[model samples]
Target: MSDITVTTEDGKTSVCSPYDTTFVSKAKTIGGRWNGPAKAWQFDARDENRVRDLLREVYGTDGSPTDDSDLVTVRVRLADHEVSYRDGADAKFAGRRIATRPGRDSDVRLAANVVLIAGKLPSTGGSMRYPQINAGDDVIVEVRDIPRATLSLEREGSYEIVGETRGEVDVDALLTEREQLLARLAEIDALLPEPEGTETTTQEAAKALGVSVRTVQRWAATGKVEARKNDQGRWIITITI
Candidate 1:
């Protein structure tokens, strides 16, 4: 909900958000510094990749978007201790479910359908106080306590009954299940504009998205890609494929 803007001057870049404590803190990690006059955080444009990731992590937007459909939001129960969302600097700072037997849930996901914890209080009664989750690949969801609900996926993936009063949930199972839950996040285009003619510092947007650079640029231009840029100049854009 912030009017955070990322702009470039010469080869350096700066991020200006709506005086947010969380944003300013995250921005500082990527070498963002306070600019009294500009009233923004300044850093090198070459570090755009890191900046973009931080924005996505904290606000779900990398100061760019392909389009509206690319952004999504969903809801889920915090069901257990094994699950964690990436809405914070680390798992320790993530938001969490207050209950497990009949846990709380949020629909926070990246375009790739990766599950993420919302940066702020995503629901009523939900608190920002997160009990740290040990980071690992082990994803175990207590399906037995879950209510019956159908989950959707990104890229027209499929529907699955992620919640149920059934049996054991393993890491491998939750890995796939994570997609269903995260796929429901409140997706949307970035409110900020991309700097004109500046080349993107990373190909992650295209590569992780499994799209060509041209396609990525087109998505960026039309707001279809998770992040995109205009091609009004000779500069070429790339993402890590």
Candidate 2:
């Protein structure tokens, strides 16, 4: 490794490894020269225990430390590619399964779960070494940019390895399922009887129309639609549908 020195306008100096200093200076001085901020240092290791120790040092806890109970689970499917790492496990790139930590900056630490391929790799192994990925012999585990929300784990101050698995649902398939559900709900709504009176309170109209109470109120207020007042003095709106 080479060495380099950087000096500030005030003549403050800092020394770093050639690679490290070049990267840092490019980030600090060149601004957009490298596209975005400098890449974070990844803690890569084959030993699970060692990986956990490194995480504790960096994240300030052995497990997720946060007051919020909302957790996130991510399943990243890498393009068939390989990458080289300090350990043999990262030689042949393969897919990885990861559960998110509770606090912010969780996405930056996914390198802790990198896994390499063995002598006899999967059928998809050939694609893992593509130049676009440059993953080497391991499968590249691509992180999904969109984060997910998950139910809180029962254990406190610790995260459980939920096990990784192959075969994932496609985004299009999920959207199709949602559309079908909405259609079915619309059919069910059509089967219900209409509200008794022409004018009904937003709440009553929502129940009778099988829609959200807010939806009914919005129509009444914005559409300049009229509603009926009940004996209890509650304003009820009749849904056009």
Candidate 3:
């Protein structure tokens, strides 16, 4: 019921309607909903950072940055009228005059191996349809208002967006920690002296124990095994000849 005039920096003035004002105010209460495909699709660094940070914060030490290898391939059924894009080989690759194109081709050629990123909701069309995706199918992401450069994967390759909760952890730190733990475990195993009265040579013990010679060496290196050092500086295992 209140009247307010909104003026833009360009000197443009517009009278706000009661309904419009309410909608605008409500939008502010929420995150400011973006309607339509054009508005909904936005590729921004801040948004990308938000998603990345959300993942990292969730996974902790177990979470690491993954590339194409991390993506899970899936396939979804597409309606005949649905529009899809795919990579084409008909275009020229380099100045050498390639026979196939590199960009997206028509939907017909793209039917197989293309992953369904997003499709028209059945509710939008007045029908109840379930969206299903199968494993090993390729993923296709539509480039709308968002710039393609923001995506981490190759723009032309088939990919799938895996849906799973992941938390943030420093990968380098995690790897280092794992290596340290393994080293410590090796040291501990080495410190465990061979059972008393067991007539087993280092190589024989290693073979009988189903462990590598390097492991036996590690035991020797850490002084786990009681052995006699000959003049050649080689340890003769005292367990067994």
Candidate 4:
């Protein structure tokens, strides 16, 4: 950084600082601007006090002195929020405002738009919840490159979700589906016909008859279910569900 000069000429006060990125940046923090000819950093001439104060801080109290006379206030639109401070009506333009309103604050408004700023949409997907805005907050938005057609917020985008994820599949959902598949397979296996001499177990017969194992065993002992023990040492019975 270097020294800043203050001058008053042609009934206009102008503050100038060396044209450098770093110096121009710090100058702007105190409301200085680069609107003058030759690209010098300049700001409100009436801001002599503030300008001197900033220069003093940068170059110490030995910095150049400035003259004080007719004071002026320069107003620039930095951003907009409340109805009173806002400059123009965005409603006059054709576009859409898609986002949830904050229950507590009006500064931020966010819906189900993919957060592609860092180079991706939403990491996860779900339903659209409440608004995400707060009062006095500035939302940094950039224009998406739509080379051909006009771009409007009303149009669907890769950044926002217009609906829910009812049609999507996740891990837990796959597990549930697998369980259903296994149950269906078991049912189909149970329905297969047996070979000519094959028979069902006492328990299988009970399951077919919708009776208890003890009841099936008692019936088999009373010759109710045709039963035999196979060479494999398993109980067998003649029954059909």
Clash totals, every prediction: 31, 23, 14, 13
Lowest summed lDDT across 10 adjacent residues in model 2 is found at: 1-10
RMSD for each of the candidates: 19.7, 20.0, 20.2, 30.3
What lDDT tens digits, residue by residue, belong to model 3 across residues 1-241? 0121121122221222212223344434433333354232122322333333322222111122232113233222233223212221211110011121122221222322232365432222211232212112232332221111123312233323334323344477558656755865796779988656554456876886688878876787788876565677765565532
Q: What's the C-alpha lDDT at position 61 in model 4?
A: 28
Report the candidate with higher lDDT, 3 versus 4: 4
Please give the TM-score that candidate 4 achieves against the real structure.
0.22
Report the lDDT of model 4 for residue 7.
54
Give lDDT tens digits, candidate 4, residues 1-241: 1134555445344655432333456777867766646445455655555666654443332123111111111111112212221221111001122232333233333322212132222222222343222222233332221111112212233223222212223456447646755865796679988645447787777777899989887887788767877798666787544
Tens-place lDDT digits, model 1, residues 1-241: 1244676657677876544356678787778878899877788876766886776555445433121113223333233232343343221112112232111233332222235443332332233454333322333222122112111111122222343233343455447545633542322224435445433633544665677767766766665533433565432454323
Identify the leading candidate in terms of TM-score: 1
lDDT of every model, 2 decimals? 0.43, 0.34, 0.34, 0.40
Winner on lDDT between 1 and 3 is: 1
**Cα misplacement distance, residue 157 of candidate 4 (Å):** 60
Query: Which parts of model 2 have CA positions greater than 4 angstroms off?
Result: 1-151, 160-170, 198-241
Give the C-alpha miss distance for residue 8 in model 2, angstroms: 64
True-structure lDDT of candidate 3: 0.34
